[model samples]
Target chain A: MTQTAPRPTLEAVAERAGVSRATVSRVVNGAHGVREALAERVRRAVEELGYVPNQAARSLVTRRHQAVAVVAAEPETRVFADPYFAQQLRGISKELTAHDNQLVLLLTEGREDHARVGRYLAGGHVDGALVFSLHLDDPLPALVRGAGLPTVFGGRPGWDEGLDDVVYVDSDNRGGARSAVRHLAGLGRTRVAHITGPLDQTSAADRLAGFRDVRPDTDPGLVARGDFTSGGGERAMRELLDRCPGLDAVFAANDLTAAGALRVLRERGLRVPDDVAVVGFDDMLPVAEESDPPLTTVRQDIEGMGRLMARLLLRGLDGEAPEAADGAPVPAASGVILPTTLVRRATA
Target chain B: MTQTAPRPTLEAVAERAGVSRATVSRVVNGAHGVREALAERVRRAVEELGYVPNQAARSLVTRRHQAVAVVAAEPETRVFADPYFAQQLRGISKELTAHDNQLVLLLTEGREDHARVGRYLAGGHVDGALVFSLHLDDPLPALVRGAGLPTVFGGRPGWDEGLDDVVYVDSDNRGGARSAVRHLAGLGRTRVAHITGPLDQTSAADRLAGFRDVRPDTDPGLVARGDFTSGGGERAMRELLDRCPGLDAVFAANDLTAAGALRVLRERGLRVPDDVAVVGFDDMLPVAEESDPPLTTVRQDIEGMGRLMARLLLRGLDGEAPEAADGAPVPAASGVILPTTLVRRATA
Candidate 1:
C-alpha cells in the first residue's frame, strides 16, 4: 500500500473559510434554519459552485468497497511467473474476503504506465492500494503520498527518506534463514552449501546475511547464488557441485530453488538426506511433497500476512482526514512488524 | 469480470454545453485568455453546478479517478483455496499496469461488511469495476450496474436475470468435461464414476452435465460430488465407492479431489490404474505430480482466464465511453468461454 497524503473534505473548506466545521457542514447540507440573509448568501455562492453534500459521501467514506487494487510495478510475464506473487495473492485474497474486502488486481508492467498509476491512485480509484514489486527508482511512493491515499507495500526502501511513515509488510527472511542454517548445524552437517536468491531484493540479501550470521566460520565461496527460481537453482547447484563436491547439505533460499537442486542431485545419482540433505525456504506445499523425499523448509503464513496488510491499511483508514483541529500539530502514523517461524519436514 | 456502465467526460459536458466543444472546454478550464465578461458569465453558469471540477479535473470533467476496483462476490476463504484468483490477478494486473491504472481488490465475507460494499461501489470512488464471482441472487451486479461503471465477471452465472448484457469471461466447462469423459470411454473403461463440484457454480453444473452428455450409459448413481478440495473429494469418493463397489474408473472434477480419492484408495488397499483407473480436471501442476503416478486430467488455464478478463475490460476503455457509441452499444454484456484440453498421464 502506498502512503496516502490526505483526502480533501468539508472540514478543510471550513478551515480555509475561517469558520466552524459544523457551520460549513450546515451550509453544505442546505439546512433552512440558518439566518435568512446568511442562508440566502450561502445558497447563492454554493449555486455558483458545485459541492456534493455529505449525504453523497458519508456512507462512501466508511462502506466497504470490498475491493482493493493490487498495483504492480513489474512486467506481465515476470509477475505471472513469480511463485511469490501467487502465494502472497492467495494469502491476500483469503484475508480480504475474511474481512469482507475483495481484491482488485492491477499491474503497471511497463515504465510508460507508471505515471498513469500515480494519477489513478490519486484520483480516488481505489479504497486503498496494495503495491507490489516496486523498483527503487519507482515514483509511485512519492505520487501516492502526494495524493494522500492509504497504501501498503511488499517491500519499501526506507521510512525517513521522502515520507514520514510508509507502511511496508515484508517476510522475516533474516530470521527464517538463520533458523534453517541452525537446523542444519544441529543435524551435524558440517559442509552446507547455500543457494541464494537474487541479490537485488532485500529478501534475498537478508537471507544470505542471516545464514552467514549463524555460520561465521563458513567459507564465503560456499554461497552459490541463484535467482529464486527453479532454473536458477539448477544452474547454481551444478556450479556448487563442481566447486564443493564434499558439501553434505544444502539450503536454498526458497522452495523453487530447492526443488531445482533436488532434480539436479537426482540426476547426479545422490540420495537425499543420506548423501546430501537438502532444505528450502517458503515451505510451498509442492516443495515439501515433490522432492524424491519431501523437503524440510521454512514456512511463512502468507495468507496471514495478506490479512495483516489489509487490516493495517483499514486501521489507517479508520482515522479522520487530516483536518485543522484548532491549529493543532499533526498526528502520528503507526507502524507494525509481524513475526515468522520455521517448519521442519523430510529433506533435512 | 462484469461489464460496467460508461463514464462522464468533458466531451459529454461540451456536447451538453450546446456551444463549440472548445468554447465549453475553455470556459471549464478557466483559460485567462477568454474575454473577462464572457468568462464571468460562463463561470457563473458552470459553477451553478453541473459537477465539481477541481483544477486537475477541469481538463477531464466529472473525473476519471483513473482507478478500477475488483469485487469478488465470494468469501475470502474460498478465494484463497482456489488457484483461479492468482491466475486472474496476474492477467488483470498485467493489463492495468500496462495502462498505469490503479487496481483495487475487495472481498465481501461477513454480513456487516457485505452491506457496506454496495455504497463503496456507488460512491464514485472508482471509474470502473471488475467482479470475480457471482451468485444469481447477488445484489452486486445490479449495484455495480446502477453505479454506472463498466464491469466484467470471471465466470457467468446460470442466469443473467436483469443484467442482460453483463460482460463475463469464462472457460468452456462443458466442452472440457465432455472431452475428459470421451477420453475415459475411449480407453475401454466400462464402469466410470464422475465427481462434480458445487452445483451453485455454473462451472460445476456444466462439467457434470458434460460428463453425462458423453456417457449416458453409465449409472446415474456414479455421479459423486466434491467442492474442488482434496478433503471433499476423499469423502465423496468414500460414498461413491461404497455405493458402486464394481466401478472400474473415476473422474474427479479437479486435481485436488482426484488426489484425495487416490489417498482413500491407497488407504483402502486398492491399486491405481489396475482395479481403478482415475482421471481429474484442472491439471494444476503440483497436485498432478505428487499423485502415486501422475494423474490424467482436463487442463484449464485459470491464470489465462484472469488475464482475458483484464483484456476485455481494457478493451472497453479504449474509445468513447460505450454508451455514446452505437457500434459498441456499451458492448451489451457478453460471455466469453476459453478452451480446455485433456492432459494424459500415468493414472488414467
Candidate 2:
C-alpha cells in the first residue's frame, strides 16, 4: 500500500470554504449537523479535486464499504433457489439498504472454494458476514472468527460450546414441532410418523426432539430421515408407506418435504386427512396456496428472523452491546423465537 | 508502477525440479501443471521460503483473491423470490468453483446504494461482476465499465449501447414467445392478448415483439404493461378482459405473472383453456409443476444461461476474450441463443 498525501484534509476545506472546521467536517464526512446550503458548497468544493478520506481523517467514523457479505456453506444454486433464501434475503437486503449497506453474496461451492471464501472473508472483503444454511459440524463459524471478522448465523446454529458469543437468529423449532404433533394427536390420528430433516441441522434435530418430548410414548420405529429436500421427503415417504402401511398420521419437517409426501399420498390413492392426517412445518406461502388439498402447516416467522439477524450483525459491527437498538423500534425481537400457529387446512 | 526485486525466477524452479521453465511456471501458477512429484517438490521448496533465485514466492501468487461479484440490481427479495435467480445462481456457482474462483453476490437495492456497488466492483472487491435483472436504462452498466470492471449481464440487456462490451447471457425470449404463440394458435385460439412486462426491459420488449411477429394482425390494442410481477399481471389481465372482452388467448411474460393472470381469470369465473388459452414464458419448474392446469408455456435455458454468464465473466477476468460457454463439449457459439421448447399442458 503506497502512501500519498492525506486526502485533502477537512481542515483544508474549512479554510477554503471559510467555515468552521466542524461545518466542513460535517459536510465532507457526511455527518448530520451542518445546514444544507453550506454542506452543498463544501461537497462541491471537495468534489472539485479528487478526495476520498479513509479512516485517518476521523475517529468517530466506521468503515463503510457499504457492503456486507452473505456466505452460504452450500451451493449458490440451492441458496438462491429456495424461496426461504429469497424471503430471508429480502429482509436483510431491505434493512441493509435502509442503513446504506450493500450486500455481497458468496457461495463456497466446495473445498477449494471454501478456502478462497475464507481468505476473501478474512481479507476485509466485506464489512461483516451473514452465514446461512450451515450444518452442525461446519468449521466456518470458527474460521470466520479466526479471521477476526464479525459473523452471524441465520438459524439456531449448532456450533460447539466454545462459540457462545456467536450471534444467530432462529425460529422456535421445538415448540413449533411440539404444537404440530399435538395438533395431529388432537385430530385422533393414532399412528403418527415423523419425517425429519437432515440430522446435521439443529432445526431438524430440535424439531424431532420436540416431537418426542410431546409424545413420549411414540414408537421410535416411526422416525425417518430427510435432507429437508422434496426428493428426500418423497423417498422417505415411499419407505414409510412401504414399512408402515397402517400409519394414520405423518408430520413432515418442512413444507417442501410435506408437499412431496402429499404427492406420494395422492399417487398411492390415499385420501388425505381421512386416510392419513398430515401436518408440515414452515408454512411457505406458495406451498400453502398451491397444493391440491391445501397443506396444513406450522408457520415460522422467517421475515422477523431475517430482520433480527441483520440488527444483531449491525450491532456487532458497531461494537454496541447486544441490546436491541434503543427505543428506535428494535426489529420485532432480539433472537426471536416467534410462535408457530397450526393452520387448519384440508390436510389435517 | 515500480519494478520490485527480481525474486527467484521460473528458470531456477525448472532447474531445481529438472524440468522446463514452462513446466515450473505452470506448477507455480496452479495451472494444469507439471506431474505430481515435481509439482510437490516445487510446492515444498516454495513453502520452505529459502529459494528466491528463479521462482517468486507463493505470497505474490496469493495476492489474487480469486473472487468475483454477482451484482443483482433488484432488491434481495426479488432475486431470491424468483426461482430464476436461484437456478442461474446454481449454474454460476458451480462453474466458478470449477475454475477455482469464489462467487460473491452483491445486492444493489436502491439508487443510492448503486454508487457503493460501483466502488465494490472497482476496488478489487471482486475481479469481475455479474449483473442480473437490471431495469432498461440503469446507469450500472456504464458505471462499472467506467470503473474498468469486467462485467456480464445475465440477460440480453435493454439499453446502454456504450456498454456493449459488457457480455450478456439470455434465453431466446423471441423464439420462446413465438413458440408459445404458435402453441396457442395450434390449439385453435385467436385474439391472444400479450400481457407484456415493463416496456424498458429487453425481455418485455422482445416477448411482445415476438408475439406480434407471430401474429402481427392481432390487435396491438390488446397489449398491457406489467412489472413482471403477479399483481401487475392480474391487473393487466383484468384490463385486457375489460378492453378486449372478445380475447380468447393470453400470453404472460413470466410464470409469476401468469400465475397472477390465472388467479384473475379464476376470479372472473372464466375457464382456463376454454375461455382463455393462457401461456407463460420461462418454464420454471415450480410454475410448470404447480400452476393451475399446469400452465402450458415457454421454457428458457435458465441454468445454461447462468453457466455461460459466469464463463463469459471468467474469461474476461483472466484477460481472455469474452466468449459464451453454453455447456457444450467445446463451446460452438459466441452469440449463443439457447433454444426453448413449448410443453403442452392443460393451460393452452
Best by TM-score: 2
Give a tens-digit lDDT track for model 2, residues B94-205.
7777777888877856666778787776665666677775577777766665444456777777764433233577778898899888888887887888999888888888
Interface RMSD of 1: 4.4
> In candidate 2, which residue ranges exceed 4 Å CA deviation?
A1-64, A110-112, A175-195, A212-219, A222-280, A286-299, A321-348, B1-63, B160-164, B171-195, B210-299, B321-348
lDDT of each: 0.68, 0.73
Q: What is the C-alpha RMSD of each candidate to the true structure, in Å?
A: 13.4, 15.3
Candidate 2, pairs of clashing residues: A66-A102, A77-B90, A105-B105, B8-B52, B8-B53, B8-B54, B8-B55, B9-B54, B9-B55
Candidate 1 lDDT, tens digit per residue, A168-216?
A: 6766778888989999889999998999988766678788988998887
Pick out the ten consecutive residues of candidate 1 chain A with the lowest summed lDDT.
A321-330
Worst 10 residues of 2 chain B by lDDT: B53-62
What's the residue-level lDDT of A266 in candidate 2? 92
Q: Where does candidate 1 stray beyond 4 Å?
A: A1-72, A75-105, A108-112, A126-130, A134-152, A156-194, A211-219, A244-348, B1-67, B85-103, B108-112, B134-148, B163-165, B169-194, B208-219, B229-348
DockQ of each: 0.30, 0.48
Query: Per-residue error at B27 for model 2, in Å?
Result: 29
